[model samples]
Target: MTVKIAVLVSGRGSNLQAIIDSIERGYIKDAAVNLVISNKADAYALERARKHGINAVFLDPGRYDRSGYDRDILKLLNNYDVDLLLLAGYFRILGSEIIDAYRDRILNIHPSLLPAFKGLHAQRQAFEYGVKVAGCTVHYVDEGLDSGPIILQSCVQVLPDDTEETLTGRILEQEHIIYPEAVRLFAEGKLKVEGRKVRSLD
Candidate 1:
């Protein structure tokens, strides 16, 4: 069965483009991004989706309260029969309604290694804190802030002359690679969640 995916975005969808490219190139097999929803009408991610002939929608945040907005998102997921939800640069914290409905089915990619530098501007947090190593993590989305089971991670070295921008750019490169790989694993039924760990079934 082809896995139907719905992506939520609020910024430039670099990761979204990566997933689309992966699907088109057959790196992610038997999966299609059927829907792309953005809270900002001007989000370039929506444009990326439309270019690929995917169903892209801009759900105005002002039209509804937090809970109501999430409820509407749930309605869209049900209407489109989305099997997996991916958050790509989406800015808002999801409420319980959607989180409970989707639970383990939702995936999010963070700039830092996770369990550290969570919340916003993770790359900057790592850079200013002077960490020697910085990377990206793909994990399941839970109620807590970026606290979810780990799936895949790729590390990048923080060079001696690297600034926050340079480090962020390198970390994002890894995010593009591992995020799609994680999605492919989920599509192939190669991922199993147990306790705080995500076991890859080879």
Candidate 2:
């Protein structure tokens, strides 16, 4: 049984590419990236999807209210028969319409070990806060801002001389690894969310 995936992005989608690569490499099985949706018209993710022969979609959020925009997106997701929604670099907070509709089926990868520096600029936030460790997390998206159940997290040490850019680079490396790992687990039916905790079963 292959899971139909719809990837949402807002910018250059390196993580989206990672997922595609993982799928192609057979690291993630029983899943196919059926569609790629971007809110920004100029997002490079759309081009990447087209290059790979996946359905690419662009929606102009400026044309509608937040509710209408998300409603249209929900319609597209339904039309494409998406089974899992992946947020690669999607910037907007998902509306309740979509969130409630997908629930745990919507997966997101954050740049930091969540419940820490959420919102935006998470790498800079950790560096400025003088944290000794920083990393990335893959989680289920809820209505709250990065307050959903965590699925997987990997950490990196903060070097004494690390700048924001250096730290971001390191964290992104882990993002590439863990995000694909998370998707693999999800595709394999190995992840379970019990309360606020997620268990990775073998």
Candidate 3:
């Protein structure tokens, strides 16, 4: 069975492109991206999807409140029959409506190692806070903020001369790598979450 995926993204969607590339290159096999949805009409991710001949659309949030917005998203997910929801740089905090609807089926990638410097500007937070190690985390999406069980992580050492941009550049590289890895694991039924810990089954 091919795993059907729907990507929720905002902004450039570099991770979205990575997943697409991974699927196309057979790094992540037996999975298809059914739809790509973005809140911003001008998001380049939509363009990336259309360029690949994949279905892509922009959902307007002005027409609905938080739960209503989630309802709209759920409608699309059901419409596409998406098996997995992948969030890539989506800025909005999801409500219980969406979280409960998708539950453990939704995954999100955070820029920091998680449980630290969550939310926006995570790279900047790590840089300004002068952390020696900064990396990315792939985790399940919970109602709480980046409090989900971590599936995979790749670390990038923060050099003494590293600025936010340089550090982010490195972390984004790791993001491209691990995001697909997590998706592939999920597709292969190799991921099990228990008590805030994600176990990888071979």
Candidate 4:
């Protein structure tokens, strides 16, 4: 059975593109992108989805309250029978209703190692903190901000002369690689969450 996915994005949707590429190349087996949702009307992610012949929808944040916005998203997910929700550079912090509805089925990709830079400016936070190692994390989306059960992580060494832009570029390369891997694992029923950790069954 193919696992249907609905990817949420706000910006360029590079990670979304990675997943689409993987599925097209048969790297992510038995998986299909059912829909792409964006809160911003001008998001390039929607254009990317259209290029791939996928269903794309925009839910403007200004139209409703937080709960109402979540309700609308949930309604769309239900209407499509979407099995998994993936957040790739999605700017909005989802409300409790969506989290409760999806539970362990929703995933998000974060720029930092997480538990370190949870909200924003993660690459800048790493550079300012002078961390030698910084990377990306793909995890289940919980009620807390980037505080979900970790699914997968890949670290990149921070060079002494690295600026925020350089560090972000390095991390984004790994993000493109690992986000699709994590989603493929979920699609194959190879991921299990035990406590705060996620394990691959195979």
Candidate 5:
């Protein structure tokens, strides 16, 4: 069975493009990107999706409250019968309704190794904290902000002179790699979340 995936993005969607490329190259075994959703109408992600001939829609977050936004998102997901929801740089803090509706079906990629920097400016946070190691996290989306069950993480060493942009650039390379790997694991039924840990079954 092909796992139907819907990706939500609010930016350039480098991770989204990685997933799409992975599917095209058969790296993600039985997964298909059904649709791409963006809260900003001018998000470059939509253009990326259009270039790949994938269905893309923009739902204005400003028009709706949190509950209404979730309702709209849920409706869109159901319309496509999407089995998996991927958040790649999606900037909104999802409400409980969205989390409850999708439960374990929703996934997100955060820039910093989670539990360290839960909210925005993660790269900057890492730099400010003076952590030598920084990385990205792929996790199940939950009610808490970036406080979800961990799926996969890839670490990158922070150079002594690294700025936020430099650190983010390095982390993003790992993000492109691991995000697709995490999605592939979900599609193959290889990921099992227990407590705060995610076990990958071969």
Candidate 6:
């Protein structure tokens, strides 16, 4: 069974591209990205989706209240028959309606080893805090702020001469790596969430 994926993005979408490339290269078999949705009209992710012949949509948040906007998103997810929802650089928190609907089916990649620097500018926060190691996490998305079951994580060492930008870039590279691996695991039914832990049957 081919897994149909819908990705939510609010930025340049490097991780989105990584997922696409993995599917194309058969690194992730029996899966396809059917839709890419962005809240911002000018998000480069939309353009990336278009270039790949994927359905790209821009939902104007200003046109609806928070619940209403999420309702529209849920509608779209239904319309696309999305099997998995992936959040890659998406800025907004998901409402309970979608959360309850998707539950463990929703996946999010955050820029820090979560349960630490969450919310925003996580890489900068880690750098400022003088952490010796920083990394990214792929986890199930719950209603809380990055408080979810972790699926995969990879750490990057903080060098003495590393700037925030450099650290962020390295963390993002790891994001691109593990996010696709997590998606592949999900597609192949290799992941199981039990309470706060995600187990890999593979």
Q: What is the C-alpha local distance difference test score of each model?
A: 0.96, 0.93, 0.93, 0.93, 0.92, 0.96
lDDT (10s digit) by residue, model 4, range 163-189: 999999999999999999998899999
Q: Candidate 1: where are CA atoms >4 Å away?
A: none
State the lDDT of candidate 6 residue by residue for 1-202, as single tens digits. Answer: 8999999999899999999999999999999999999999999999999999999999999999999999999999999999999999999999999999998999999999988999899999999999999999999999899998999999999999999999999999999999999999999999999999999998
Give candidate 4 regions above 4 Å deviation.
Answer: none
Native-referenced Cα lDDT, model 2? 0.93
Native-vs-model 6 lDDT? 0.96
Error of 2 at 88 (Å): 0.8
RMSD of 4: 0.8
For model 6, the run of ten residues with the poorest summed lDDT = 110-119
Which clashing pairs does model 3 show?
none
Deviation in angstroms for 191 in model 4? 0.6
Tens-digit per-residue lDDT, 1-202, candidate 5: 9999999999998999999999999999989998999998999999999999889999988898888988999899899999999999899888888788888889999999988998899999999999999999999998889989999899999998889899999999999999999999999999888888889995
Question: Which consecutive 10 residues in model 5 have the weakest lDDT in total?
Answer: 93-102
> What TM-score would every model get versus the actual structure?
0.99, 0.98, 0.98, 0.98, 0.97, 0.99
Candidate 3 segments whose C-alpha is farther than 4 A from its true place: none
* Tens digits of per-residue lDDT for model 3, 44-71: 9999999998899899998887788888
Q: In model 3, which range of ten residues has the least summed lDDT?
A: 94-103
Give the per-residue lDDT digits (tens) of candidate 1, residues 1-202: 9999999999999999999999999999999999999999999999999999999999999999888999999999999999999999999999888889898899999999988899999999999999999999999999999998989988899999999999999999999999999999999999999989999995
